[model samples]
Target: MSKPSKSNLKYKICSLLSLFFMLFFLFPSFIHADTSLQGYKEVFQDSPIIPFLNKKESSKENNKEQYQRLEDVKVVPGGQSIGVQLETKGVLVVGHHQVKVSEGAKSPGEAAKINVGDTIVEINGQKINHMTDIKPIVDNSGKENKKLQIKLKRGDKMIETSLQPIFDKKEKAYKIGLYIRDTAAGIGTMTFYDPKSGRYGALGHVISDMDTKKPIDIKQGSIIHSSVTAIEKGDNGLPGEKQASFQTQEKRIGNITKNTDYGIFGILEKEVNHEKYEEAFPVALSHEVKEGPAKILTVVDGEKIEEFDIEIISSVPQKSASTKGMVIQITDPRLLELTGGIVQGMSGSPIIQNGKIIGAVTHVFVNDPTSGYGVHIEWMLEDAGIIKPESNQNAA
Candidate 1:
């Protein structure tokens, strides 16, 4: 204590300075009171973590309004692709699949007649799905990499094929290019367009390979009719899954557009007429979006159409597929109380603002159902490759 070290002296000086700074910073609050909201804003932004705090705070203030919009969802005209999904009552998805090879074994995939992304439904008069279901097959097939026969369903097309596995020297195991999915998870919209251009897709965002969780190849997919049998709500901690039946009737519309974060798209075989519906209006531009209020046109509880109020949070300056901007809040207690905010099947619901169709609800926040993502109507129109791009300000 008689002789303090240099490091110790520096530490004490720093500590005293820190105390002085703290007192100095706090003195202001003593002079001028800080509001509660101000404290929250400071605490939120000043914190090292909580990156999205500002966004959340902004949303909390912007999305509450009554009588905003719930106008009508109308389909755009001139879309002509007959792309449709085969309806199914249920589908099983899994990974790392094995199948049988017919009488005279055909080449691997041909023997199984399986496409790269086809969901394997059954094998050898057996409904092969989960790992436990094929434990016996794996044990039996382990004996030898011999040819085998199997039956498979590729969307609407069902076929039989032969398969043979090859042993990999590095891994010392038999390998087949077969992958499977045990459960089909996603929201699929039906379309009336089917094109022979060897082009069609569903779930605008590609279906993931259950095993690797990668996008599956769509060029090999066949359209199936999946009828909605049950729908689960998309909410916090649990993203709702949509289930449907695979039916044979090949009813569909439009060429498939690329899968987007906003959901899937296809050329419309039949336009959903926003104009024909009650209170139909012209679609609005992103620049025209007003933050006060709006309504979304959607089908809830099988009613085919319903209206609800929501506030527009923000809008973009340029056109984009995801352009319609707004952090909408459901003002209708009936909608909020009955279904949370946005539901799964509500993906394509149209949002009308100021007598113009502007956006479609795309996704629901898993944690907050009432809050979700919406795609600008212009993006859908552009994806169709039909709607002409608007002229820029210079042209105007």
Candidate 2:
């Protein structure tokens, strides 16, 4: 080949440099979207609910000042295994199946333009609070040959539509052709418990429906005792998991009052004993978190809470609330050997550094099982109502 022109070579170098810079800035966000957090599997069960949170915000300056004043707030770090059961405020529309009727098979819900992830809050002017509440109204409407007016909550918008129930010849019951669920149950470690407020935070992330992938709009929920029975070690491209069972007979330790982007928050009915740290301690703000050695409290065997060493590979002082505020890697040989790094059901395991709780493990890197994401403790506290509750509310 002939020698290339200097101008052509310069242009090629510039293009290559631009590509490198673009990938450098874009790679982390891409990884964030792929990082998987453990603990959002739906289990059929009964659960409780949470109250509406005030999401009004003050000015940014006021917000900073308010957070500064919250430095003295103390919380008991939680690492005990717990079972979470959440019931949706109204029955959720997860999917639609064909209803076999005398006329033929059809889906009334799909025909009505009721999409999956919609929450049916009312039917025929009657409020729908449970799956049981829907059947009676549907049956009556079908018998009366009347179209039912349905009110649904889709995201932040409330809309209405008409849906006619079809009579099934085989079962002789009216059907809407929508598969719905009211409750979701799973296992996770608790992040913190504020004794003074009886409020606790856990999971370090939202509980989304497995099918719809939307946050569960809880009517009520409960957190019961749980035990870690087994672990599936993590590996490249495959995240590990903590296999656990709920202590059903044991009284619920707390009631789930809120499910937000940060985590689940609720009022504790009783103290969660068996935590590694018995006494309440201060929490480091996002700005206070640093890149250094840290400890994480979690359960690898049974109900026993144990501390494992980890390192804060990087920490960011966030001006806005975010779930991935810190990058962490498991440094303890025992933890690495036993679990192969962060696993499912360990999302809310508390991360302590320099005697202060700084954050909780939230997600695991799919490509590197040894490293994961940590959310700043301040955001969890805010979600738990232990600190500034009026601002930055993204509750599910």
Candidate 3:
């Protein structure tokens, strides 16, 4: 019942302090339990919690970025013949002729300075979508003796002109002496098709008028199955062409939605069969294309889609979009002997290299039928709107 000595008390206090220090070092989590609430098992400056949270946030951002990427994109390589029918936005002036009037032979369109290749979009504030749409306006304006206010699209410019319709004695109707066409049709090859979306692209170049050489402004059109009837051999100075006959109504393929510099795009109503390349294939970026041997899927004769050998003479690693990205030459003796190299209607033939679709044949050299220019598939895919293009990036 007596008080302890100071030395013993000091020793006991020292032992108590030693025990507290040991326990704190051994079980720091139990001593500092508040650390758990802050998402940390250990109370340290470089705790793994911060790294884990940062990693999780980075992973979420990466997932979102990958969702919009084109790494999973695959397309079916097209090689069959397609008959394209393009209806213009309005009646296109193909030529100007003299109208035989009672007074004299004169051309109202020529007098108004309305050149050929101009698309007449409106007449007297009435929209003209077809060649037939002009007759009523012409007749009414002529009977009233009113000057026709013509609005047209020439290239990217919209122009307005006034033309006075003349009474044609030969045709017994009012005439502007402008030969206009509302529709154009031709045969070309298919480039690629996204099987998942049923969207397709074809004719690696724009469809232009033979006389005016201006890109056709498409309003609405369609494509149908076509059979190659014959092939004209190409020469150094002359380009060959494929003569194909469009199939019947049952062969209606798809409707043309857009006609761009990269070619034509549409949603296919039915799948286009590729006899050899039946499966979807991946496409290469422009920088990935290498100069070497390659193969092209195209029809040489009849309805048969065949593979032909070709050489990639050169390929450009483009930082921006371009229509011509590579130089190609026909090396297949069979193809050379058959079509005399890259001919017309073979513009959209899929160019494959190293098991990847690199591009499509765009144009044949006028001086060298054996060699031609090919466009990178990325540009065509971007124009087709299959993949979203990044700003200043070569491809999506």
**Model 2 accuracy (lDDT, Cα):** 0.85
Misplaced by over 4 Å in model 3 are 1-68, 391-396
Tell me the alpha-carbon RMSD of every candidate.
Answer: 20.9, 21.0, 14.3
Worst 10 residues of 1 by lDDT: 191-200
To one decimal, what is the Cα RMSD in angstroms of model 1 from the true structure? 20.9
Clashing pairs in 2: 48-220, 48-221, 49-219, 49-220, 49-221
Task: Kindly provide the TM-score of model 2 when superposed on the true structure, using C-alpha atoms.
Answer: 0.79
Query: Residues 1-396, candidate 2, lDDT per residue (tens digit)?
Result: 999999999999999999999999999887765452111111101112211111232233222432324647888999998998988999899999999976779999999999999999998788888888988888889999999999999999999999999988888898999999888889999999875556789989999998899999999899999989999999999999999988663768888889999999987766568646778888888778889899999998999999999999999887678999999999999999999999999999999999999999999999999999999998898878777754333221
Q: Largest TM-score belongs to which candidate?
A: 3
Worst 10 residues of 3 by lDDT: 48-57
Query: What digit string (tens of lDDT, one per residue) describes model 3 on residues 1-396?
Result: 999999999999999999999887878867566555344422422432122123333333423431124677789999998888889999999999999976779999999999999999999888999898999889999999999999989889999999999998767899998999998999999999886556788988889988889999989988899899999999999999999999544687887888887889977776677788878899898888998999999887778999999999999988778889899999999988988998999989999999989889999999999999999988788777777767327353
Backbone clash count for every predicted candidate, in the order shown: 77, 5, 0
TM-score (C-alpha) between model 3 and the true structure: 0.81
**Cα-based lDDT for every prediction:** 0.48, 0.85, 0.85
Could you tell me which residue pairs clash in candidate 3?
Answer: none
